[model samples]
Target: MENLERMEGQCLCGKVTVTAGRRDAVEACHCGMCRQWGGGPYLAVHCDSDVQFVGLENITVYNSSDWAERGFCSECGTHLFYKLKGAEEYAIPAGLFQSGSDFSMTSQIFIDRKPGYYSFANITPEMTEGEVFARYTP
Candidate 1:
């Protein structure tokens, strides 16, 4: 297991805040749903379930799929996390956290679903949509 570091961040309007264990590597999700939700690929860090939220009343969670949900700050419209249902896992947007300058882009998922108009310069590992399902889904 890797050592986890504590990190903190707040929503754009400061109405919501998060304190969580930080993962060093950043990942991009290029699936259509992710792009549609964010207007681009989602750059995130895996924070697992070691997260605490302040101002719960200001947060809104949307069930994006049967197995997963997306969260945002209702007051500021800041995207919060993509979480797996009934699991201790979360993909929190990297940009939301402070001191994320050291986070490295290490992987990209849903490569097959990525649009041709955009691409990343990093030569990180890539996973297709099917591969992601096979590897992550039980």
Candidate 2:
């Protein structure tokens, strides 16, 4: 079960505000697209449908795939969230949130896509790209 607590966050320039309910744990995605987008594994907080946004004008959404889109703060080019095309599955950068929540790294997706140049010390559960696509397909 997920906690019902609300977590608030904003972009670097304070142009975009995000609010989401408590997530179980933060996770990382190391797919090529994710790494290319953020320069490293994308540390994201999965907020299924409990997410809200303020300062809509400051946000820009890019359809990164046929079934997903990536959002960013136009003012500061801050990566805000990645969302499924027709659903409310939102994965936002964990760093955007204020420090206080008890966040833990519980898993990593696109494990095979992860480069061998670096690795996390945490012994988290990992999934390959095929597994992720099967689970997240619309």
- Checking candidate 2 for backbone clashes, the offending pairs are none
Where model 1 places Cα greater than 4 Å from the true spot, the runs are: 1-3
lDDT of 1 by residue, 1-138 (tens): 445668998889999999888668899999999999999999998886779999999999999999999999998899999999998888999999888998899999999999989888999999999999999899
Computed on alpha carbons, the lDDT of every model, listed in order, comes to 0.91, 0.91
Candidate 2 C-alpha lDDT tens digits along 1-138: 667888889999998999998876899999999999999999999997869999999999999998889999999999999988888789999999885267889999999999999999999999999999899674
Ten contiguous residues minimizing lDDT sum, candidate 2 = 95-104
The TM-scores of all predictions, comma-separated, are 0.95, 0.94
**For every model in order, what is the number of clashing pairs?**
0, 0
| lDDT of candidate 2 at residue 32, scale 0 to 100 | 95
Local lDDT at 102 for model 2 = 77
Give the distance in Å from residue 40's predicted Cα in candidate 1 to where it truly belongs: 0.4
Candidate 2 at 121: error in angstroms?
0.8
